[model samples]
Target chain A: MTVTSPEKAKIELRDVRKSFGAVNIIHGLDLSIEGGEFVVFVGPSGCGKSTLLRMIAGLEDVTSGDIFIAGRDVTELDPAKRGIAMVFQSYALYPHMSVRENLAFGLEMAKTPAEEIERQVQGAAQILKIGPLLERRPGQLSGGQRQRVAIGRAIVRKPLAFLFDEPLSNLDAELRVSMRIEIARLHRELGNTMIYVTHDQTEAMTLADRIVVLRDGRIEQVGTPREVYEDPSNLFVAGFIGSPRMNIVDAIYAGDGRIKIADTVMALGQNFAGVAAGDGIKLGIRPEHLNVAQSSSTALRAKVDFAEYLGSTRYLYCYLPSGETITVEQRDGRDLSSGEEIFLRCDPERLRLFSTGGDRLRSANTAGMPTA
Target chain B: MARTRNSSARRLFANIRYHGFGIVVGLLFLAPLVWSVLVSFKPSVEARQPPLPPWPVDGFSVQSYDNLAQYGSGIWTYTGNSLMVSAATVVASVIVSLFAGYGFSRFRFPFKNALFVLIISTVMIPFQSILTPLFLILTKLGLQNTLTGIVLVYVTLQLPFSIFMMRNAFDAVPKEIEDAARVDGASVLRVLYRIMLPLVLPGVVTVAIFAFLASWNEFLAALILLTDQNKYTLPVLMAAVRSGQFGTIDWGAVQSGVTLMMAPCLALFLLLQRYYIRGLTAGAVK
Candidate 1:
């Protein structure tokens, strides 16, 4: 019962906009998603990431523009006709039904033959590794197990794409991490296009082939996780990605590709276009890039406010002379006390510079990332 | 010694006060139903005796049960009518209310809040105020004494509160589930049928039971709407029988008939007690 890949299309959206009466959401978003690629829309709460996913799935009506899925103009089509399956935050399992029945629900609705439906359900159950739990209701299973059943339910449909709206948000933290990997693996095996929506940055970073970062109903940046992280398009993406988040400190352009921060003139060896001498800018450095400076390197002197020590690393929360704080990820596990004087050095090449208006400035040659 | 004495006094007083109050209240409410069952087994003279029928029944006989079957005209017919009407009311009201409730809960149209307020306001209006006009309207439509008329009347009357219960039920259900359903190729109605309906079933059942009981036990409207003895429902017949049209009350027959009328509702509650109490605990979980 294999669906013969159905000639999947590069889902393209042109000036897609949505609104609720006078209040507009999703302000003129334009994006093109290639076939067989997994894209995740990640944002802070109330950013309309889920709203965008719903629009793609045809659950929401697009106020403006066309959505083409598989080369079919489906902007005004019914959800059933749109060829997408969704896994929800709450799983949306039919409580009265067993896992097997839940998995077979979409097929049943489609009026598939009973044997084929059974085969599809069995295949999904095996894929999700929830075959043993197939006879149980969602209420009878644990959160992780219910999530598997939810995924299995989607797989049975064998749609052109999968839409997930924070499917792991209901689970505990540990389970979320594991399920995140499982979903990534599922995408690899299925080789179908998938679009997931979540507010969890880890979910976006770990799972997305291309991450769509949204803020306040508008897409801030869209790129691969490495592309978005290593070369963020905006200051929002810089701050949003990474665990011990990227530190943003106010700095001024200092006569070259260099920036002056808190009495420290850092030498950036590359030339940045459109950056002027006195332009107010912010230096963005990932915690892992900043560390304890030794032997008189160009350093930003700071006092450690506190430290959060993980087994493998410790995050030194340090503040510059002007009072802006930056986290230094010390990998060698040095135990630093509060108010300890420290010199933090970022290897200038890895420093992310954003103009005051929050746009990522294109430098001539930032060593780790391609300048755009 | 003072601490120990005070603790003992507190325990003794607490046990007497709380437990005593609960027992008294329970007995006060339960006494009549227990008395009703007991009195039904008593002989005609014993039922209304100055001392009242004896507890545990001095002697129970089937004479009343037999007399009820033989002497009560249209009693079984009326009971059947009540069952038909109420069952129809439960099914019809639940279906219509579920749709309207979903609409109110999910969709936003122009004047949405005003529409919801209007629906809720119907609940606050006294049924007695609209009874005459409603009856006249039904009469003009040739639905006056028919079971369909009764069902129609019952459904419309029950709809307001039914919608209220179901709207809250739909609200308690995560809207994300329906969104998921829609994304899973379900149409709006399919989403309701597949995902939303089953989750809110306990609430729907609770509303249905209420609808069932209201229509089954309804007396005033049934009395006004129906004239034919065969068309009379249980409550209407029960009220008429209580008048004791024959010189002295045939307490045996009346008791047995009352007992019979109570059986279905009791059985229904027992069968659906799980869902009935589930309404209380619906949104307790996050």
Candidate 2:
């Protein structure tokens, strides 16, 4: 979770803020994205992820702080002068132009020689595998092809960085997954610094070397996918990063390093000897960590509300007697069905303790650190 | 199979009835123009005969056309004046309104709403009310009876609707496209001219056609403006035909004059018909 890499001083945002007249969109945000790294800014819609990307691109003015690209202040530079290219969600390809012209437009605008522009356009088309579609207009191509042309347009610019805003959002599911892998592969091939913004966590997780989790215009966490998923610094990151979001249950600190949740009593592994009793807390558990084990000290009686069978795996949405719902991911073949009664168990080390205010409460595990 | 045949026959019959009614309406509207063309070929006396028995084709002659030409058809001069004024008005109106439209659609400067409302409001006011003041201003500028002066009036009269149409057209063009152009290193003017303009060509062409027809066919203002026959536009000259030069009417010349005036407007309409309708419908979708 603490792993870090070099090139960490590439892009620096020094207390950046964006405002439209009286209303501010981005509060003072300060995050340095490293060079040659694929960083994704993710949040729900209207969280200003796209706005922040545009601001960093110099398309939107940073109302307060300075933006530095490659250690040089570029707060007032134009987007092209800032050495960045962007892929818009709508593809933004010139509808009247052929794919070739779309890829060559920025270069043409910069007056790159006709021959050089042709070479770059062809090279980008070949890289995106849109070579055959070079003659086709945006209106003629499929959505996925148009998206590739958009990415090709950005690629032909060959800038220091690439900014993408929900580029795969308009594609079908099958194309989305392929494009996600293609983007990751592109990062591998190009090794150029890329900043992507999306509301979809899977895209953020798969494409990002480091993911910046945002909420309502402020960043909540900045970490790699593994760090955000398995060792979230707060409740927001934990709940936002994973599919079948981490199950958070209410608990009260019982006497002698134990916590009580509904009717079950669980040990906290002696890390909380300095804490008092009856402190209100929350327990965080990932669905896959909830197992059926006879050796566990605590158990909850749950009735299955429903079960989803996805061939090799099953997801049981179980309701405890206290009326709290929890999802259990089962990989083994089991006859788990709706309304079935079973006891759910989790290891003491696997349980995450949080304050009532949605902050993870860390304690030294006597057994060892919870290895994810 | 019989049911299918009956349904097919019913659809065919419905189509025929629909087209038949449309044809009747079209014929009724076109009756005058057709009669004008036929009258252009008839002798001065025969032109008065009702359009029946094919209008005595054997008796048809070009004497009227020759006489009208000899008696100073001035049709050529009128046509030249109309063409000059209309062409200038179309070009000037399209370019000026394009800038105004882009401003109203894209920018948020002060007084934008008030200015736009003022422009659109002028459309509702009758042109006759402003003609007097407008004429006075033109007289002071020494613009009356000249093509440039008349074109100024045409452009001024048409700019309001041009601004409204072009604004709607520009509004229909996605802001993202222009923003993309900006990020692609295009300045605002470059974005407007190169990217936004091409995408809204249908709307622009439609507006140009409207301006063309308006200036070419404008009668009242041209009558008030042009004093000399040399500066007479087609509409003003066509109106002159309604009152003959002599006490008696010159049916031959009047008929030919009416046809001459109608040709440019109709030809331009037919040429850009598709774009015209499409431009009108463009605002709805975008």
Candidate 3:
């Protein structure tokens, strides 16, 4: 009953695509996931992250290209033969089977010996702390216990990898937080390549070793949590990765060293490759980076519309002179009345510039900026 | 206080009306069974004099039940034949419809919906319209006068609704459960028999009960297909006994035959009514 090390099993997708009749779902995509990496696919609904994960799991047809799991061509392999186990959002435990039976089912199907099956089932139950619930049916258990039984069922297989399809979405907020930590701990202990799909950015930010941001069936960015948060690849990633999302506003390239936004000019210390004078662009600033400044020509003027106070920090919702909405994070506990005019400023290097097409334009002087 | 009293009075009136209507409808269905039982107890001479009253005028006796053996190879032969035909029909129909139902509910194939529609549409065609053709087909197949032929016809007749009920039962199970089973290394047939079938047990019981009742009470098909006197089911023998030679009808024998037919159906329904109701509402919401 030795558990196989998953550190040698890498998964790669080469030009994989999926379509339903004439409607394309997943566009041609190529990605290589290193062994033992915990990758999270994060996207809005209809972004095809679930479809992509299902394709990798062999539950869905690839429609076009090849997939390799542990250097084996698995495009034609059955799901059971693919050496992976999946924990579904609905838990999908056999309602008629006891937890012990559920955990032992896959091994039984493989014709494993009875002693080994018992050993593995008990081992999984102990790991999941479901030993007391082992003899109970799924309907008799609570939601969290049912999910634990589901994970136990997966782990008894000792699969090459684990696929989670929004496994925590059905739990309450408190349970979701606790279960998220449990899964991260499980990944650390198991050391298997895990591909998790969720639309919640917090799950992506907290649990992922690398988050693959998807939009409209295509990958928008792939980076570590800090990289995606501070140095996003596009406007979508910038707006998607943070809570109280990054503020985006229309701006114009005023000249060689400055940008103009609603008649207020700011100096830039870095050169952008394709930007020219009088070109329209978008400027993004994280809420925490923007702060109140004394009235000045260089600062943007805004009137506070509302404030949401969370114990340590408050979000000041405001509108700019151009009638665009912006949020500023205020941790100083100052009481600002709605409709009070305020000037806001930020370090020029903290700004994220995007082209009209929404792709991020990196600043050459990024090294000067302080790290979070 | 006045408003509360008004609402309570209205609720009391509604309860009375509800119970009253239920009592009337319940008795209306029970009346035929009561009449049959009463007639079975009365002497043949007094049974023939009935205006179909609720009770027998003469004192009750088992004379009619005693007289049941003189007609058509005895009551036991007819009962055995009926039991065999109905049991075979239930087994065949339940198995065929269980597979068909799971297939129709889960898998997609070319013209699957059209095929399902074609199968279900058979329920709408009157048996009389196909009687002549069915007779000729059974004759050509050399299945005439055999219990197999009648069982086949009963199963064919019961399949449309049986499949429909089974499909709904399987539909109530989420697709993810089946996917999990498959990923757990179950073959398609294993998934049906082991995982899916157990979940849909109520539907299976419902199908079995329906097939049982349909084959048990079916008269015309059995009368035509089962030309052999020994092969006649309960209803066919009952019909033969009721259509007494010339103009004489043995009311006692006829009523006893009916009570015999009613006994098994009643026993089955009483035992499995819970499953029947559960199956009917199985996929209605989920």
Q: Which stretches of candidate 2 lie over 4 Å from their true place?
A: A1-9, A270-276, A292-297, A364-372, B51-58, B67-73
Q: Per-residue alpha-carbon lDDT of model 1 for A1-372, expressed as tens digits?
A: 223354354678889999988999889988998888888998889899888888988888999988988777889998878888888888888788898888887888888999999899889887888889888888899999999998888788888888898999889999998999999999888888899998888888888889988999998888888888898888998999888789999999986777889888889887787688988898899999987876354788999999997878788888889988888899876778999898888887799888899988877554346433
Best by DockQ: 3
- Candidate 3 chain A: worst 10 consecutive residues by lDDT? A363-372
Q: What's the DockQ for every one of the candidates?
A: 0.59, 0.64, 0.76
Candidate 3 error regions (>4 Å):
A1-4, A364-372, B1-25, B51-59
Positional deviation of residue B265's Cα in model 3 after best superposition, in angstroms:
1.2
Residue A322, model 1: lDDT of 98
lDDT tens readout by residue for model 2, B1-286? 9999999999999999999999999999998888887777778777655556434465777766665664444567767788899999999999999999889999989989998999899889899998998889999999867889889999989999899999988888877777677778888888887899988888899889989989988999999888888888877776776576667666766777777778878898898988888889887864
Report the TM-score of candidate 1, chain B only: 0.88
User: Mind giving the per-residue lDDT tens digits that candidate 2 earns over A1-372?
Assistant: 121222232778899998989988888999988888899999878889999999988878789999988777889998878778889999988998888888888988898999999999889988999988989999999988988888888888877788898999999999999999998988898888899999898998888999998988898888888888887867887778788889888888896778998888877666653345888887788999987544343887788898888887788899977799998887767787788788888877777777778777776443234432
Each candidate structure's TM-score, on Cα atoms with residue i matched to residue i, is 0.89, 0.93, 0.93
Please list the C-alpha lDDT of all candidates, in the order they appear. Answer: 0.84, 0.83, 0.89
lDDT by residue for model 3 (A169-263), tens: 89999999989999999999999999999989899999999989898888888888998999988899999989989999999977676889887
**CA error at residue A205 for candidate 3, angstroms:** 0.8
- Candidate 1 clashes between residue pairs 3 or more apart in a chain or in different chains: none
> lDDT per residue, candidate 3, B1-286, as tens digits?
9999999999999999999999999999998899888889888778778455646777887788888877769899999999999999999999999999999998878899999999999989999899888888889999878888888888999999999999999999998899888789988899898899889999999999999999999988887777789888999888888888689988888998888889999999999999888988897785
Cα-based lDDT at residue B13, candidate 1: 100
